[model samples]
Structure formats: C-alpha cells, structure tokens
Target: MWHSLVRADNLFGPRHALTAVHQQLDVLQGLLEDSRGEYRHEVLRLSAQYAESAAWLHEDSMDMASAETWTSRAMEWAMEAGDEAMLPWTLFRRSQLAAGKRNAGQTIGLAQAVQRHERALTRPMKAAAIQQEAQGLVLDGDESACHRKMDEVHEYAASVDSSGDARSGHGDFCTPSYIEIQRANCWLNLDRPDRAVDTFQTALAELPDVYQRDRGFAQARLAIAYVGIREYEQAAAEAAAVLDMARGSGSGRTLQEAVTAGNALAAESNVPAVRDLLDAVKESAGF
Candidate 1:
C-alpha cells in the first residue's frame, strides 16, 4: 500500500494521490478501531505514514491549511504510537512546511528540533534535517552558514549505502543528486544563478528518471537560471518543456516555478519565442 502511494505520487497529480491516501486512511481507521495491543499500535503507525503522505501532497499542491492539518494529525498519531523515529521525522516535515511559508526562524527552529533526536534518526534523516536548516539559512541570507550546513548534510548523506535506504523508508530521497539540486536552489536564492546553471545541469543529469516531479522542478529552476543570464531563447525552451510537464503531472509546485520563469521572461516579450512562451503560460494559468 505504501509503495503504491509512492508510485502514485510520482506518476500522478496531487488530486489523485490525495484521493488514494484518504481511502487508505479510511481503511486504517476501521482496522485501528477494531484491533488492540501490538496490532493496534502497528495500525496506528501505518495511519501516521498515510497522514504524512497526505500532508506532503497538500503541501506540494500549495494547500497550506490542509497540509498543516494533516501534518499535525500525523504528529499526534506518531506520538500516540510511541514511534520515536516518526516523531522526529514529523518535525522535519513541519520544517519543510515552514520553509514553504518562507519563515526562516520557524523553519530553522523546527529543523533543530529534528536534530535533537539524533539518536532516533537515521543518517539520511539527519542529512534531510540539516539540509532543510540550510534552506532556512538561505532565507536569512547567511551564505557562509548555509554552505557549512550543506557540508554537514553531505557528510551524513555520504554514510548512507548506495541503495539510499529506499526500503528502510527513512530519507530515501536524500541521495547525492537530491542534495546537490537543493544546493543549486540555494544558489538561485543567493542571486548566483550563474553558478546555479552548471550545478543544476550536472545534478539533473544524474537524477533518476523515476523522479518526474523532481526533474520538472529542476528544469523549471534551470529556466530561471537562463533568464537570469539574459538567455531568453534557452529560458523559453526550458519553460516550454516545464509547462508540458506541469500540465501532465498537475504539480502545483512545478507549475509555480514554471510560471515564475514565464514572468521573468516577460521583459523580453519583444522576442518571438518569449512572446509565444508567455502566451502559453497565460493560457495554462488562466490569468
């Protein structure tokens, strides 16, 4: 069931994924109410997992209120089940939500809370928490501190086996490529899109094909990098590709980034390609 949810999230849109998770949650609730003892505890843990999945779907869809509600429920279930590992992971997820809101202080504080449970956290979890904190540092414009934290994140990530603990279900996405892509995003935030272009290209090349959303996101950012350097043609090309992905996947996050690239290219609307790309974006976005 968990594997299905993961695959659905990768291949389908947030609306589809959320529907599946909610159906699973309904079944889990019935099982939880009927079972007792260790079996009930296991059911509770599974419920927490589904709830967290829903939280992530909501966040990616840019539905902050639903995301917050689901995340809080996941945390509550994790605590009730006495799942120590999940408790910290929930905190890490909250940090991501804070980062989405651009709340540097809250993001950093929640990530630090995740780190405080180091004994319960897997190495990948540690790396994820640290990487998230570095994003907060980027928001604060602390380039040096962000780099230092990224170094620490890589150290933790390096210790994970090559398989990246996919079955272990802890920080499976904290692979080297994921970390590097995040660093490229930070570079963009720091107004170093010149450096970001090369970094994003390298990371995207190494990124697995299974990560459709990730690919679209990186491509969207790469479009922004081209726009930053006044490469309107390349930016338009990338934006067109990202728009296709966004339409196919219905990924609000990817769509948002693609829209950003479109807006950035608007200044060069005199260029035929740029004008066409803007028209496409406007048509897709319905604004």
Candidate 2:
C-alpha cells in the first residue's frame, strides 16, 4: 500500500501525494485512538513515512512552513519507530527544501549530516545526498566544490549500477539517470544552459517509466534551457508538452514551470506556436 502511494507520487507529483499522506495520517490517528498493540510499531513507522512524504510534497509546492512542520513530525516518528534508516533521509528532505530556497548553507549542512551517518545509508541514498551537496555548491557559487562533489556522485552512481538490488524502498530517487538530472540542474544554476540541455536530454533518455513527475521536471527544465539559448520554437514546444503533462497529473509545480517558460518565450517571439503556448500556460496557471 505504501509503495503504491510512492508510485503514485512519482507519477503524479505533489498534490496527489499530499492526498495520499492525509489518508495515512487519518488511518494513523484512528489506530492510535484504538490503541492496538499488535500494530503499535507499524503505526509509528507508517507515521514517519507519511510525515516525510508530506514534507516533500509541501516542499515541492513551495510551502516551506508546512514542509518544516511535516519534516519535524517525520523525525519524531522515525525516532519513536526506532527507524534509523529514516534519519538521513529526513535530513535529505530538509536539504531539498533549503535548496529550493537557495539557502546553500542550510542545504550543505543538512547533506553533511547525512554523510556523517554514511555507513547506515544504502548506496542510492548516499548518491542522492552527495548530489544534493553539489546542488548546494552550485547555489553557493562554489564551482570547484560543486565539480568535486559531482565526481564523488559519479562514483556512487557506479556503485548503484553495479549492485543488482532494487532501489531501497526507502524511496530515495537516486537512479544513475537521476544523478545526471541533478548535474543538469547544477549546470542550470551555473548559467550554463547549453550544458544543462545536454545533460537533461541524457537523463530523460533513461529515466524510469514510473518517474513521470521526474520526467516532467526534466522536460520543463529543458524548455528553460532552450529559452536560455534563444531557441524560442523549441522552448515553446517543450513548454507545451509540459502543460499537457501538468494538466494530466494536476501538478502545480509543473504548471508553474511551464507557465514561466511560456511567458518568457511569448515575450521573445511572436510566432503562432509561442502565442498558443502562452495561452495554454495562462489558462493552466490561471494567470
């Protein structure tokens, strides 16, 4: 049931994921009120899972206040459940929020905390955390540090590939392709959209079918990269595709990115494709 919810989140993005979390919280509260001993540990562990999922959903929606609340709740439940696996993951989640806000100090600090427990983490989790440090470095304007960390990330990615085991059901998004996606994001942050475009396209080629939301993110960023390079037609096409995916999945983040890209394209080009894309964006974004 939990894995299915995670699949739904990966496919549909935050709004649906938030819905799933609410349902779990409701179930947890009912179980608590009933005081069922047989399910005691299960409830606590599930609480941590739902709370962490909620934190990520809120963070993706840019609701930092709610994100922080859920992140704290997640940690509390993790401790109560004796779930040490969740420790670094929750910190990783917090780092994501900090990254979104461009708070490089907080992002790097949280990722280092994850590394402190390096032995406990699965390779995929470790790779994801290290890549996040690279993300923070990009935001911190530390190109040298970012490049060094990315090298470490590739080594971790190789380990992930060599291991035949499935990604930890801990739900860390750390596939080898996901690493390249993060690299693309770093390039984007560095104002080198040409490099971002190359990396983003590579990541898109191999991203798992289940990661529909992740694919949308890459596509949206690719659109932004096209605009950065003054390829207005390509940008419009990519943005239009993003809007279609956004509409299908009810993904607010996707809609916003598409709209932002569409607006930029509209400003630069008066072509029919650009105009149509802008109209779609405005309708989707209610702008």
Candidate 3:
C-alpha cells in the first residue's frame, strides 16, 4: 500500500496520496502498540518500511530534515529488529541523503561504515558498498579513489551469478539498473559528461517503461552533465523531457535537480535556451 501510494504520488501530482500514507502510518503505529512480543518484530519491520517510504517522499520534496528524521527512524527500527544486514543498507541510504545535501564528510563516514559492516555481506551487498564508497569519494573530490572504487564495483557486480537468489542486504532492490544509475551518477560527479551521457543512454535502452520516474531521474543527471559541458541546447532538451515526465510525479529530488541545472544555466546569463529552461523550472517548482 505504501509503495502504491508512493508510485501514485510520484506519477501523478496528487498531494492526497501523501496524506493517505500518513494516515496508514498512524494506524500501523496503533496496531504495533497493541501487538504482542513476537509480532512486535514484524511491526517494527513494517514501521521501517513506512519510514523508508516517507524518507523517499520527503527527499523528493527537498525536505531534508523530514527525510533525515524518517530515514533515522527506519534505521532505528531495523536495528531493533536485530537485522545486521539492514543496518548497513539503512546507513547507505543515510549516506546518500547526506551526499544529496553536499555534506561530503557525513557521506564518507556513513559510506565507510557500510564497507566496514560488509564482512558478512553477500556479493550484491559488497557491490552496493563499493558503489556507496565511490559516491562518497566523488563528493569528497577524491578522483582516483572514486574511479578505483567504481572499478571494484563493476568487478564485484560482474562476479555475481544470477542463478540463485542473490543473497544480500537489499534483495531485489539491488537490481542491475540500480548499479547502472549509480555508475552514471559517479561519471557525472567526476565531470565526465560524455561518459555520463553514454551510461544513461545505455541504461535507458534496456529500462522498462514502468520505471518512468527512474528514467526521468537519469535524464536529469544527464542534463546536468550537458550543462556542465556548456551544451545548453542538449541540456534544455533533456531538462524539458524530464519536466514533462515529472509533471504529476511529486518527485522533489528530480525537480530539485532540474531546478539546480536550470539555476546554473541561468547564471551563465548568455544562453537563451537556458533562460527558457529556467522559466520552465520556475513553473514546475511552483515557487
């Protein structure tokens, strides 16, 4: 139900979906209060999921404080459940949240903890840990370390046989597309605009239509790369496409990226396409 609400809110511009989720969370909290000890664990797990969903929503909206609060709550619940694997996964999310805020120190610290806790992790988890480390390194401006970590991520990912259920902290959440997107992000942060564009294009080629929001996100990153390269025409084109897809999707993160890119272009002051794109962003930002 929470997933459905998140999808609906993301795909459609419906504020009511968020309200519904909050109502459901309230009910779940009441139920947890009345549940027994054995059931408490299950309740905690559900609470964690709720918190995670809330964090995603808040992050999309650029509500960093709310996002952090919910993500922290999710981690606390996962720890209470005594799920060692989930602890690292939640820490990874926190690292990502910090990175989004451009807090390099926090991102690096959380990412290192993820790697440290990966001793008992399976192949996929190790790949994810590497990916997080790469992200942190990128934010910290450690170009060599970032590239090396990305290589390790690819190497680890390539070794994972898909014959059995890929044992990891995240299970089905650790999909190939996820890794590809992470790599694309790393390329973008490293100022490899051409590489970032290529990676995103490749991922989009095999990506399903159901994941439109994810695709929009990738395009937003690609647009940023275009902006970095001073390719105003391409940046405007991609930013427009992303805005069209994100119209009703309540994805604050995607919108924020678009806004940031537009702001950058606007600051350039000489690009007409960029000015037009900035106008579009202002409309979408509803500010």
Best by lDDT: 1
* Candidate 2 vs 3: which has more TM-score: 2
Model 3 lDDT, residue 89, Cα: 73
Which tens-of-lDDT digit does each residue in 1-287 have in candidate 2? Answer: 66667777787777676787788888886786766654776788788888887887776675779889999988887877778788788998889888888899999999989988867787777887899899998999998899899878766663333222233545356777888888888888899999999999988998877778888978998899989998888888898987877776666667777777887786765788888887787677552
The regions of model 1 sitting more than 4 angstroms off are 11-16, 158-165
- What's the TM-score of every candidate structure? 0.93, 0.90, 0.82
- Quote the lDDT for 154 in model 2: 68
- After superposition, which runs of candidate 3 have C-alpha atoms over 4 Å from their true positions? 2-17, 119-123, 155-173, 267-275, 285-287
Question: Residue pairs in steric clash, candidate 3?
Answer: 10-249, 12-248, 13-248, 60-252, 60-253
**How good is model 3 by TM-score?**
0.82
Candidate 1: Cα lDDT at 19 = 83
lDDT of each: 0.85, 0.80, 0.72
lDDT of 3: 0.72
Candidate 2 TM-score, true structure as reference: 0.90
TM-score for candidate 1, residues paired by index: 0.93
